[model samples]
Target: MQVTFETPDQPDVHALIAELDAYLYSLYPPENVYALDIASLLAPNVEFAVARDAGGSAIGCAAVVVTPEYGEIKRMYVRPTARGQGLARKLISALEEKARAQGCSVFMLETGPTMQEALALYERMGYKHRGAFGDYPEDPLSVFMQKVVA
Candidate 1:
């Protein structure tokens, strides 16, 4: 597997994002969903990356919206077939490294409680529960977390 920085508008990336969007919307109300759209991902403040398999097929993707205060994780997803192989961790680590390079030591993310595995992963990765940051309104369905990189 190879992970590299890439634009989010590619065909395969769009497919992956579409799948992730569908899955999230299915699980949560539309108002509670906060995944960034293509335009948002393409904005100057966002950095996106894609993970490809040995065959060069896009298997996963992640992004971070960088700010002076913190880097907010967004659009993190791996195809169901690609789960359990550590791709998610790799993608996140890459994003953190990029954020650190840009002078950010804090990382924040908002996920849903229904995603037990994701919440567990974030906890294991050293992110502690926190209140909603940025423009996100306080919502019962949202679980926010933060980590300060050393």
Candidate 2:
């Protein structure tokens, strides 16, 4: 498997984002979901990466939205068939590397409490619980986390 930076407009990436959106929508209410749309992923400050299998099928994706203070992770997802193989962890590591190259010293992300697996992964990766950042406000349904990039 390989992870590479890409725009969200690619057909496979677009389809993967659609699947991610559907999955998130199913897990959280509209107000609690904060996923970035394709246009947002194309923003100048955001870098998106996709993990592809040997055949070049996108199996997972993640993004880092760079700001003055930190890089915010967004739209992280791994296809169900691709789970349990550390693709999510690989995606996060790739995003962190991208963010570090951009001079970001910190990384943050917002996820829902219902996503226990995600929470566990973040914590294991050294992200600590934090209050909301960026445009996010305090919400019971949102769990915020951050890690200092070494």
Candidate 3:
């Protein structure tokens, strides 16, 4: 899968992010979904990446936020039929590249313990468990992790 970084105004990108957000919300409760929506990912410190097929279809997307302390990952999703094809890894790699370009030294993410596959993927990608940060409360369903990006 090829990952492409595009402007927020790009057609279908925002909608795709919304679809991914909704999918995540359905997996975990709304209260446990800590990250903000697509508009939030467009902040000065935030950026997004889209994974497209060889024919140029938007098959997946992920977002990254660069902070002074670390890089935070958000909104990673591949189409239902696209699972197990390494698209998630591509999206993640693109996000990490963007993070490193912005001088971020570490990467953080908040997912859910119920999402075993996602947790495994993140761990395999070098993200280690971490305490909740930002506005996240001590919710049992929430799982936070971070990676020191090279």
Candidate 4:
């Protein structure tokens, strides 16, 4: 699989994000789902990327939004058929690298408690539990994490 910085509005990438949105909505209430929409992903401060298979099919995607304080991860999703092969790790690493290149040493993200696999992956990647930051209010359904890259 190949992970590269790309536009999120492409057809295949849009499909991937839509699938992710449906899954998240199924698992959480609207207020608990803080995913960035396509237009938001296209913002100047956001860096989005997609993971494609050898045949060039978009199978996974992620984005990092740069803020004055830290890089915030958003819209990270890997298709179900493409899971268990480290695609999520690859996508996240690519975004982190992009952030690091831009001089962002700290990374933060907000996920849901019900997403066990996502929580485990974040923990394995050295993300520690933290309180809500930015404009996010303290919500019981939210899990906030942060990582500092050297």
Candidate 5:
């Protein structure tokens, strides 16, 4: 497996994003969802990462949207067949390294309450629970988390 920074417009990456979007929408109402779209992922402030298998098929993806103050993780997802291989962890590590390179002091994210595995992963990765940041308002369904990028 390999991970690299790339534009989110690639066909495989688009398909994966669609799948992720569907899954998240199913888990949470539209007002409660906070995922970045392809255009948003391609914006100047955001950096997208794609993980590909040996065959070069896009198997997972994540993005970091950097601002002057901090970086926010977005659109993190692994193909169902690709889970349990540490791809999510690897993708996040890559994002954190990129954020550090860009001088971002903190890394943050918001996941849904139903995503227990994701919450556990974020906790294991040193992200602590926090209040909503950026444009997100306080919502009962949102689980906000953050970690210093030191």
Candidate 6:
């Protein structure tokens, strides 16, 4: 597995982001979803990564939002058909490593309340439940989790 980081403006990066957004939209109605789009995740503070096969075709991607204190995982998605092969975990480890290089000591993320598989992945990856942070309001539909990356 190869994990590569790049500015979201890259063509391959944009392709992954488009696929991610389309997948997310298929999971929920646009009005009911809180997912970020390609442009939003391309903001200055956000660093993105792509996990590729030996042939270098992207299989997964993650966005790590850097801040002075901690980092937030955004737009993390592994193709549904690619689940159970550790692609998601690879994307996560790559992002965490990049975040650490950026001086971040903590990692946090939010996922839909009904995403049991994702929630399980977070738990298995060492993230613990936490109260809402940042612009996230305490809502029954959202689950917040965090890890100490330092």
lDDT of each candidate versus the true structure: 0.95, 0.94, 0.82, 0.94, 0.93, 0.82
The candidate maximizing lDDT is: 1
**Poorest 10 consecutive residues by lDDT, candidate 4:** 90-99
Superposed Cα deviation of residue 73, candidate 2 (Å): 0.3
TM-score per candidate: 0.98, 0.97, 0.91, 0.98, 0.98, 0.86
The better-scoring model by TM-score among 1 and 3 is: 1
Clashes by residue pair, model 6: none
Q: Tens digits of per-residue lDDT for model 6 on 56-105? A: 77777888899887899988877666778888888888888888987888
Per-residue lDDT over 16-120 for candidate 1, one digit per residue giving the tens place of the 0 to 100 score: 999999999999999999989999999998989899999999999999999989999999999999999999999999999998999999999999999999998
Alpha carbon deviation, residue 99, candidate 5 (Å): 1.1
Better of 1 and 5 by lDDT: 1
Clashing pairs in 3: none
lDDT of 4 by residue, 1-150 (tens): 899899898999989988999999999999889989899999998999899999999999999999878999999899999999999998889899988988999999999999999999999999999999999999999999999988
Cα lDDT tens digits for candidate 2, 98-132? 88998999999999999999999999999999998
Q: Which digits, one per residue and each the tens of the lDDT, describe model 3 over residues 1-150?
A: 688787655677767767777877788877677766656777888788888888887888888888898888888888887788999998998889878987887898988888888999999999999898877776788898988855
Off by over 4 Å in 4: none
How many clashes show up in model 2? 0
Worst 10 residues of 3 by lDDT: 30-39
lDDT of 5: 0.93
Off by over 4 Å in 6: none
List, residue by residue over 32-98, the lDDT tens digit for candidate 5: 8888888889899898999999999999999999999899999999999999999999999999998
TM-score of 3: 0.91
